[model samples]
Target: MSIVDKVRELCGTKKITIAELERSLGLGAGTVSRWDTRIPGIDKVQKVADYFQVSTDYLLGRTETPYYALTEKDEPSIQADLERLIEDLDGLKYSKETEEFSEETKELLIASLEQAVRIAKMEAKRKYTPKKYRGES
Candidate 1:
């Protein structure tokens, strides 16, 4: 969907007109409607996003999720799981004289694992959380 369409949808949920939204954000009249034909500045988009409590990516149609809660990278349970998985990998012997994962390879694996875990946590929260609790209308 276009940015204008998304804005319109959000406005409808809030029972506010586009003009009201513009005025509330201190934007000029018809500025948001004009986004249908003109590319709006990032600052304007960010302002609208902040007002709506949604991500700029959602307003820009880059993502379907509107509100993505922050994930804790240092969650004790997740970190413990990561460590256990790494230990399991280390326990596997590729060969008597060869290491299964070099230092650089281990670093890369850890980074990838952390990223995957973060995404998984976000998706789980988004999927399982109720719409009212998630701030969705």
Candidate 2:
């Protein structure tokens, strides 16, 4: 089943409105509405998945078991917890160097870092210099 189908199933006897989910989760209505057709972001998917105590894979129709299910009304605390978990995981992944990175992946990483360095230098210049005296773009 798709994520929308799983979310509807979890709603059960009561109807779960998209607005309710949006408001409770502090997300835009369009974001939830898009889930009706497109693949959701990890954060949005995690919001629904966290509410149902299920893994994002399950919510995305990639798995079957509901990992940690909760109610439709649990968009707040559940989303917060899920976001925290995601952030923690991201931090760990970014900090750790992989034993194996494909040539293409390594090249892409290098390119991205080069752009990031340029952006950082620009930002540092902006912070230290007076606006009127700053170098032209």
Candidate 3:
């Protein structure tokens, strides 16, 4: 879906109209609607993403997952986690010699671990943050 479409969909879920969202964000009239034909500025995109509590990647349709909130600084930590997990798996001893994971399997495992970490972080934020501080009621 287009950025405009995604924004509209999110507005729908929040039970607000596009115009209302524009007003809430202090944007001019029809700014978001124009995104269908024109590429919006990064600042505008970020404002919309922040208002909806979603990542710009989700708003831009780069990712289907709306809440993958990992930032650039978190990338190194995720990589380290993946490496440590892989090493732990490799270190495990079995009755028979353990076979090494295929490259594809390793990739899948890393992706799964990354996603799991993202979910855990999101959950922690939701659980620990005060309701007044969150976007939701």
TM-score, per-candidate, Cα-based: 0.51, 0.42, 0.52
Off by over 4 Å in 1: 69-137
Best by lDDT: 1
Regions of candidate 2 where Cα sits further than 4 Å from its true position: 13-15, 68-137
Positional deviation of residue 14's Cα in model 3 after best superposition, in angstroms: 0.6
lDDT by residue (1-137, candidate 1, tens digit) is: 89999999999989999999999999999999999989999999989987877777888877786765544543876678677777876666454667566678778888888777667766676566554554432
What are the Cα lDDT values of the candidates? 0.78, 0.57, 0.77
Error of 1 at 51 (Å): 0.4
* Model 2: per-residue Cα lDDT over 1-137, one tens digit each: 66676776766624667567667778886676677787778877767655544456666665564432233544464455545544554434432465455667656765665555445544554355443332211
The order of the candidates by TM-score, greatest first, is: 3, 1, 2
RMSD to the true structure for each prediction, in A, is 11.0, 19.6, 8.7
| Model 3's TM-score against the true structure | 0.52
* TM-score of candidate 1 versus the correct structure, residues matched by position: 0.51
**Which residue segments of model 3 deviate by more than 4 Å?**
68-137
lDDT of 1 at 13: 88
